[model samples]
Target: MVWPIDLAVLTLVVMVAIGSLMVKDLLGAAILFGAYSFMMCLLWTVMGAVDVAFTEASVGAGVSTVFFVGAVFRTSRRTRD
Candidate 1:
């Protein structure tokens, strides 16, 4: 794997992780988490772990993101007194 590309993807992964945590909106955080998962899949692909990469892409980025967004939509934006 080329060091520069790997470093870039790794940097993106870290940035996305932090961004997801820092996001105030649940939907935005879920999108960031999906991006993070996609970056992780790319990192795994660069490392020659194709199976793991596929799993991350499918389960982490795909299914989990859908679930998170759905859950976020279902939740009411209300603060209980």
Candidate 2:
């Protein structure tokens, strides 16, 4: 099936990925990464890959994002510009 939504989600994923890498702030990067993961989940869902989408939602957006945020907060070292 031709999916216009997949293209949109892909575009959003790319933009979020680029923004995540470009940001200097650790917290912002983490949030952007989470957004990227969510977009990936959406893309997979659109592509009819429910298993992959669910995994991405749980591991990428959920556990990974939470881990990053928690680690950033727990760490004493500050991110350099």
lDDT score, residue 25, model 1? Answer: 77
lDDT score of residue 17 within candidate 1: 97
lDDT of each: 0.89, 0.88
The total of clashing pairs for model 1 equals 0
lDDT of 2 at 77: 27
Off by over 4 Å in 1: 77-81
TM-score of each: 0.88, 0.88
Clashing pairs in 2: none
C-alpha RMSD (angstroms) for model 1:
2.9
Q: Model 2, residue 42: what's the lDDT?
A: 87
Worst 10 residues of 1 by lDDT: 72-81
Cα RMSD (Å) per model? 2.9, 1.6
